[model samples]
Target: MKTARAMRGAAARRSGRRGEVLAALWLMAKGYRILGFRLRTPQAEIDLLAIRGRTLAVVEVKRRTDLLTALETVSLDQRERLRRAAAAVAAQRPALAGASVRLDLMALAPGRLPMHIPDAWKGA
Candidate 1:
């Protein structure tokens, strides 16, 4: 049997994954093509990678009670890690090479649509 904390953590992970899917769909509806999800590099795991034209978006999905809280979950250090991961991915992926990358946050709150904040964290 799993402990209560572990159960909660599992549930949270599920919710986060769901949010990510929702965010990707939302981005698609807004005309962005999702290139990857939960991409792992040595530095960090990017929740989503999207492209529109020559721009690449490194997305972070957060599920919280409200948009503000969800956005707040992406900390500065986390942003830096994401930036590093994006750079690494761009270096390895030919499609993303030389693409302009920006960090974005998709904030998911209950009973509401996901909010896509582009350039959410500027350069970590």
Candidate 2:
């Protein structure tokens, strides 16, 4: 039998994956093409990478009780990490070389449609 902590960890991972899938579908509905999911680079792990027109979106998915809480959860350090990860990924793919990067957030709450906030933060 799994320990309590292990069970919680597994549940969290499941929730995260669900949130990411919802976020990807939401992005696609908005005309963005998903480039990757849970992409791990040397800089950080990106939840989702998408492109629409000339913009490349580095999306972070949050499953929370409230949108405000989800939005507040991304710290400055996390934002910087996402930016760095985006840079690393972009460099690796010629298709993304000239695209502009936008840090985005997809907030998911129970019974509510996914809330996508484009340009969610300006990285420092």
Candidate 3:
């Protein structure tokens, strides 16, 4: 049998994957094409990479009890890491090379639609 901590970890991973799927569907509804999911580079892991028009969005999905808490889960350091990872991914793809890139947040809670915060973090 799995230990309590292992069970919790599994549940958390399941929830995170669900949130990412929801976020991707939400982005698709907004006309953004999902370029990748769980893009992992040496610098960081981006939940979702999407493009719409001339914009490239590095999306972070959060599942929490509240919007503020969900939004707060992404730290500044994480944002910078995601930005750097995104840059690397963009460099590898001709389509994303010159698009404006930004960090976005998709906050999810029970029974509520995903809240998309565009350009949520303006990395310096």
Candidate 4:
């Protein structure tokens, strides 16, 4: 039998994946093309990568009881990590080199539409 902690971890992973899917769909509806999903880089794993016009969006999907809580969950360190991951990915993809990277957050809550916050953090 799985331990309680293990079960909780599994459930959290499932919820995170579900949030990512919802975020991706929401972005698509808003005219963004998703370039990567659950993209793993040396620094961190980016939940989603999207591009529209001259901007490349690095998105972090967060699910919580409310939008405020979800928004508060991302730490400064996590933001730095996301930036690093974006940089690493950009370095490897020539097509993305010239695109301006924008860090975004997709906040999901129960019984509400996903909230997409563009330029969620200023790039370092």
- Per-residue alpha-carbon lDDT of candidate 4 for residues 44-110, written as tens digits (9 for 90 to 100): 9999999999899999999887867877788888888988899889889998878888889899888
Consecutive 10-residue window with the lowest summed lDDT within model 4 = 115-124
* TM-score, per-candidate, Cα-based: 0.92, 0.96, 0.95, 0.93
Model 4 alpha-carbon drift over 4 Å, by segment = none
lDDT of 1 by residue, 1-124 (tens): 9999999999988988888899999999999999999999888899999999989999988887877786778788888888899998898888777899899988887788789999987654
Q: For residues 18-79, what per-residue lDDT tens digits would candidate 2 score against the true structure?
A: 88998999999999999999999888899999999999999999999998899899988888
Query: Candidate 2 local accuracy as lDDT?
Result: 0.92
Error of 4 at 95 (Å): 0.8
| Residue 84 alpha-carbon offset, candidate 3, angstroms | 0.5
Residue pairs clashing in model 4 are none
Report backbone clashes per prediction: 0, 0, 0, 0
* lDDT agreement with native, every candidate: 0.88, 0.92, 0.90, 0.90
Ranking by lDDT: 2, 3, 4, 1
User: In candidate 3, what are the lDDT values of residues 4-67, reduced to their tens digit?
Assistant: 9999999999999989999999999999999999988999988999999999999999888898
Q: After aligning candidate 1 to the native by TM-score, how far in Å is the CA of 63 from where it should be? A: 0.8
TM-score of 4: 0.93
Full-model lDDT, candidate 1? 0.88
The TM-score measured for candidate 2 stands at 0.96
